[model samples]
Target: MKTSIIIADDHPLILKGLNDFLLEKKYNVLASAVNGKEAFELIETHNPEIAILDIQMPFLTGLDIAKKCKELNWKTKIILITFEKDENIYNEAKNLGVYGYVLKEFALAEIEHCIDSVIKAMPYFSPELLSYLEVEETPKKLELLTPTELDILKLIAQNKTAKEIGELMFISNRTVEKHKSHIIKKLDLAPIQNSLLIWVKENQKHLE
Candidate 1:
């Protein structure tokens, strides 16, 4: 069976181009939407195998959709396409369980490679995106977890179950669990109240 897909982008041309490209690739273009609401409707209805979402949309952002999708346990893999290559977005996508992320500026060839790599059960980042010099925070957040801990937390926020995150990060589920515990403690977050995911969103800008 062909891999099913739904693409959501506010731009008409992008939606059409993505649809045409995926159709040419022999992937089933289940649906396309210009905004988050339409995308949500089609996604819930069709249950496509993959979803290509633009980070900036009419009403709801790609980040919002990703968080909701994680909650639903939707089987559709998501590719977040955006012009923003900042650390915050990367951290957010990693946390939200998005299957892949591609920049709008990347060549079609790079995007294709990213898609193929993601389908093969690997995380994909464009050379340009990864090569962008990281602007380190002058001083680390004392209340924040370590980089790895944050990474695990980001995946948690993204709604990835322990095992799924483990597979992506090449770590054990138990390790992810331990990181979760440490993250909670470091952030002094009360259990069963504000979720770690909330902390991630609240403090995302500082991660870079």
Candidate 2:
């Protein structure tokens, strides 16, 4: 069966272009939504195999929709399309379990590969985004964070509680708290009140 998809973008031309291109590729385009609100409704109603959402949208951001899907345990996979090269945004998407991240300028050439990868339950990050990160200088404290610690921090930044983070990561709440403590110490923010959360907010731009 052809892979079914719902696409959401605020820009009409880009939305139509993507719709036309997917149809040309022989994929099933279930619906097109002009804004995030409509997109969420269409997704819940249709339950398409995949959702391609623009990062910025009216009423709801793509990340917002992704978070909602994660919360509801929706089966639909999400692919976020954005013009941002920010690491924080990318990390947040990763934490939210977004299957694909495609840059707008590279969409025409890379979108097919992205969709195919997501269908196979593999992640597909834009090559351009990866290349940008490769060249960017890593911050000292960020470098000290273990992969697991960084993942937990991203969840915390999204306001997920320890229990929620533990459930998502399949670890215990105590383990999550332990990791949080390590993160705070590693970042050298122990002196500040609510230091981890404060540091996450303050350094979010660099994290991105």
Q: Report the lDDT of model 2 for residue 27.
A: 94
Looking at model 2, residue 146 earns an lDDT score of: 95
Q: List the residue pairs that clash in candidate 1.
A: 95-154, 95-155, 95-158, 96-158
TM-score of 1: 0.64
Question: TM-scores for all candidates?
Answer: 0.64, 0.66
Q: Rate the local accuracy (lDDT) of all candidates.
A: 0.72, 0.85
Candidate 1: misplaced stretches above 4 Å? Answer: 133-208
Clash pairs, candidate 2, are 87-208, 88-208
Candidate maximizing TM-score: 2
For model 2, how does the per-residue alpha-carbon lDDT over 1-208 read when each residue is reduced to its tens digit? 5899999999999999999999999999999999999999999999999999999999999999999998899999999999999889987876677888899999989999989977866567887887786533336779999999989988876767789999999999999989988887787654422446545644555665
Candidate 2 vs. true structure, TM-score:
0.66
RMSD of each: 7.5, 9.0
> Lowest summed-lDDT stretch of 10 residues in model 1?
133-142
Measured by lDDT, the strongest candidate is 2
